[model samples]
Target: MQNRGWLVFTLGVVGTLLALIGIFTVMEGQGLIQPRTIGLIFFFGTVALYAVVGLMVSARKVSDYYVAGRDIPAFYNGMAGAANWMSAASVIGMAGTIYLLGYDGLAYIMGWTGGYVLLALLIAPYVRKMRAYTVPDFMATRYEGNVARSVSVFAALAMNIVYLIPQFMGVGMIASRFLGLPFAWGVFVALAVILLTTFSGGMRGVTWVSVAQYLILLVAYLVPLVILSVRLTGNPIPWLAYGKALEQIDAYEVVHGMTRYVQPFTNMSRLNTLGLIFCLMVGTVGLPHVLTRFYTVKSVRDSRISVGWCLLFIILVYISAPAKAALVRNDIYQNLVGTPINQLPAWMDTWGKQGLVKVNDINGDGVLQFNELTLHADMIVVGAPEIAGMPYTVSSLIGAGGMAAAVSTSLGLLMVLAAGVAHDIYKKMINPNASEGVVLFWSRAVLVIVAVLCALAALTRPALIVQMVAWAFSIAAASFFPAVFLGIWWRRANAQGAVAGMITGLVVTIGYIILSHFYKIQFFGILTINAGLFGVPANFLVTYIVSMLTAEPSKEVQELVTELRFPRATRLIGEEG
Candidate 1:
């Protein structure tokens, strides 16, 4: 009866939202609402909804705050997980990347999708079995020492903060473009909502809210693509119908004297592409924010099941990316290219004012050439409806969807950062006797501080959204992947070995990224994005060598590894230990 009621409520909310969107679209067509007003309503209306849900489900108990009382059903958990996983990079930057990079951008699709498979097969269920509150908690218990816990904490903070900055950048982009705020100020606007959603409900609030966000973002993403597809090829399904559009894009490139859109290895070296895919695959298993989602489910089996649902939801966005990219590119080629600068579409002026689209007319032709215009990767998805001459309401909805993607992921990353500091570091190491109230208080405190710091960093416009996210994946791959993987599979993996592995991997990967990205140091011709290629192997070697040289783990620790490998019952790993 309870489940049926919840189902009806969900359907009602979704139907109401769809009706509102339809009415708004009609209103915009009829000139009853201004474009700016529609954008504001769409963006803030969803944000207001998120705020309300956060307040309604705010966490009170420690368990609720950390793991959502371990009560999320598999289906909803999967929906929430999909929302949490599809950050701004996936939601906003991906289609833009495909538009810009052409064939090379498929690397992201392959890497991220394949990475989730690795997580599902090799990591999620085992992590759930451990039943630890945070990844560091699992490390400390598994390795029997604070050194391992502290190192894991550092890795989580480093990866998540790096990941978190791009999410804020996404928010800033959406707010600046849609809400008419300065980019820096826009970042803080999102910070307010993120803090409200996360500071109160913690994981519990984030989970339910993420389900709502997933629906909005998914709809916002697909609707524009489907409309564009039908307009271009008379097919409502973009994924299956975009092939002809791709051919048209290729022909346009040829006529414009540009590299073909389908040409592989034109933008990235083959080695770098493969290396990036490998790092992303391993990194998916290492990300603390993603692994924490599995901990919120009811059982290990549910955790595994949720991964399947997550992939289903995520792949819907992924498969549509190429279609969106191709159709948008075709639109630009057909409508904007060769037009006089002053005669270009209205979207050029709108996005140009925000510095997202630039036109130079380098050949003194007064007409825009493909080479003379530059489109920022972040703008492609959000600005697609405008580029295709769709209704203003469609573009407004895309802006709102982008906000949802950014907010949902931001909430998860914020929780991971807070738990790493407040739970793993403060309560466990500094003040083990602290009461739950004191701990929750500190968690909220850390959430604000970390969010403010990341927001400030986002104002600098560090890198493209996808590039920063890829860096996070690389860091996670290098530092956490080996430590966690070996700790679970190898009984001889002691605290000393785990600590050494994490430190070595983290130092090598970060050092390479800094040197290669800032100083132009060439490392076997590998791009900085693939720096994890060097770190993952180094960590594995160091860990293996160090573990072999050190005395083996005690019998109890060895037994725990055996139990993790072959669970005799549905008990927590801590209980068995």
Candidate 2:
């Protein structure tokens, strides 16, 4: 890498960190402000300002904006990409969602992580070899027809819209409930923040902003668990407390004295355990946004480091969550449940009125059951200060962390969505002769349009973060995983086969989800299944069958594939270097 690259990347990161400091120092509504409002504003405001700084520093070069001049380091790139891939959804939503779902939620964790392996082993290095700016660039180069181009465009669109919704919805949920503000206002605030980062700087600005997001997300999740774990289990490490947590979830019926909607997941059978983990882990490799992270890495090795760093950061929250969930559940049962209704913790009454928590005390037991608390699980973090008797200031800081995590991720997704529109479509397929400046203009322009669309989707909001995220993962698994993996390892793969496979897999997976979710099917006097259940096999089978039947790839595509598989050629590499 050249000094020019180093100067740009270092300057970029330091600038972002300074901006974060400045933003934090200036925060005014620290006490009266709800977590949602402060989080949404500060995160968006601070990062947007970073983007503006980044744009000013590098606006002279289109290449700098697109890929940081292609000199991003393996280690830092790994960190940046990991943070980019993980968002508010992972930091704020995953644990709470997992706590409620138990073993079922492991599927999301596995699916998200697994998608990156597919990127490293199958698609990323080869895509890098293609020397293209985005994922669609690979599709365009691989397939002979506009068919590949069209699929790439639609895939990027599908991945972006579905992924963006949860982010907006979450911000809306946090703002309206936490701040006592209208949900639409939360959506608008987040939109403004996202626009500041993406519209100003494109990928370069977004990258540094994500680094700040990662810090906020990790700290917010880690601190509470550390405090709870040491107090409850006499063990500072929460990941090791899975047995205790599972035992808690298992004993909910006894603890809360409510036997309804309480199943002993701890006693899950062997087959059930295998099925749950397998589905989640294998599905991880299929997510589009995760794969997109690899595009930012400078090399395949760097891509691998990014995944390793990602897993390291991800495990911080993943391991602690079950323990925290269990501890919180126990705390609720021991101190709050079975108490006089008004005697419940002050935090409960406060957040409960905000719809963050609710109590029926249906058994006349004067206790809130584990089942009774699932609806309120999302607010546990925000309510932790009052529940555990922490200082009010600390609680506000956590809120700030959560909002920052969410905004940073939304910004990353926002940038990716913009690139798909501008670089993938406007410059690549639509105008082959488009100048670098035209590309830069279209990229930022598209960034603005997508930001508005995502904010609107947040208005309706979804039922929960996990559901929307799961749906998106299922879509990616069916459409991308099979095709990309086969393309890399198999010799027989061709444009016809790859195209056939993607369409077949995507349609089967997405169509089934829509049908099963929206309406059930009637077939020959027998009712059959939810969509993802049947869709997975359909995607693989189509990819395999189509690849087998279609002619092998063109000579040029095959040679490119060979080159991608081999060590970098000194002659060619030096020439480029």
Candidate 3:
């Protein structure tokens, strides 16, 4: 702990750099200068921010840098985690998804909100009490062996790489849209900027940076939606006003109103819609960066506070997303959806030029239908900024906000990336006695390597918004979440069982994802997100089956469990073993 000398200076510099980036991004978007100037601003802003933040916050002690001193207030940790988890998908994509899919998009809304609750109630406290700087640390002790830790490390690492793909792609897309640059350049620029900031801040800088970014994401999504909602319906409560089916209203009167358009929601059923929502809600608790935040808090109770805050921030965006989606869907249909194809709004015509807005004019009435917005389902939010008719400044602000969301989530993943390399693989097995300096160096190196690789993946447009991260969430749920929950709650859950469960889940998920990516399979009529619909069940079955066959853990493992249960009696001590 004494080795962490750079902590304070890093925070000051990173904070300053973020503010500058925000200012420059806004100014550049306002047309205050050239496109290249905006690029320069983002580049300088990220570099200076990371350099100062990194050099100041983390010294040679990996634990301090990785876990934020393990004395952070639950509220602060929760706030940071919220920013980290929201990402580009939440801030910029979810509402758009709903707009494209009608009420069916409620799946993301409920799932994200429900996830934090699950984390607070089911996973947070015991893991925080285990006192490991990372999730794999808990697995090692619960299993009473290195095998569980190894398995967990690999799982956590793989899931994170999967997680990072969409965010980089988002930032790139956003930059390309706002900065008037190529998508590849935007991706490279964001990657370089994040690599600099994350390599230095480690986890410590990330916590503060994330908190600031959370504030940005919430404001970005809510402010524009609020304005759009209030402008359309004299009411600020858009959710209630907009959430109705087109048939539920007086279609004739609404058609004549000339103010608000109607969305046809009669086709969306509750049962199927709710099922997907349930999967997301429960699956959310199992996400890696999400659960890792519990380790940053000072105590078990603090962990609960963090979950609450996370839920609260998410709600701010969650409520607004639906509101925005409904309003946009109606607004588009009322004004432009039915208009002559060439008579579409300037925004659509311009965006269509960029391949972002593709109107099908299905009836050849030159009218755009709700189904037309589903061209890819990912462009809803990005297209929303312009549809609201906000000035370029506000649109740029939203773009900046989206970038902040992407960056915040990216940093959190990068920290986990650093930890997987430094703590799990390196300290646990590679060279148990590697000096603090060497560990710290490797941490920075890991950040650089992972950021670049993720940047490469982003360039390829590898996966769409929800699908890319959704697969990662499913993995977390089936594998890590089950093991962590059962490890703490079930006394008979030995290292062997946990290992077997993780291996089963990991292998199944990889195979499923690969098959979906390289091969294809259809189940009944509806093809699955991947082959993994089968894997989740297989995971739970194998976990208990293996635990039954294996001998109970030695008394030492039981003793460790007891200690974990009594979080305060023995502070979650790390194994210096």
Highest lDDT: which candidate? 1
For residues 1-577, what per-residue lDDT tens digits would candidate 1 score against the true structure?
6456456746765776789789988888888988888888888889888988888888889889999999887878888888999999998889899898888889898988898888887888888888899999999988897889999999998998999999999888788877778888899898887887886688888887898898899889988888999887898988888888888888877876889989998888889878878988898888898899999988888888989998898999999998899888887888788899879888889889879899998999799988899999888888888787789889888888888999999998899889999999999999999999999989888889999999999999877778789889999999988888888878889887888889999999999989988899977899888889988999999988888899898888887777676433533445543
Candidate 1 global CA lDDT score: 0.87
Q: By summed lDDT, which 10 consecutive residues of candidate 3 come out lowest?
A: 258-267
TM-score, per-candidate, Cα-based: 0.95, 0.83, 0.86
Clashes in predicted model 3: 9
Output the better candidate (1/3) by lDDT.
1
Error of 1 at 270 (Å): 0.2
Residue-wise C-alpha lDDT for candidate 2, range 404-517, written one tens digit per residue: 667766766666666777777777678979898888888778777777887887787644665566666556665666666665666567777767767776677667656655
User: How do these models rank on lDDT, best leading?
Assistant: 1, 3, 2
lDDT of 3: 0.70
Residues 34-112 of candidate 3: C-alpha lDDT, one tens digit per residue: 6555544543444464456556665345677878777666556676777888888888778777766665677678777
Model 1, which residues run further than 4 Å from truth?
252-257, 340-342, 362-367, 567-577
Clashes of 1: 0
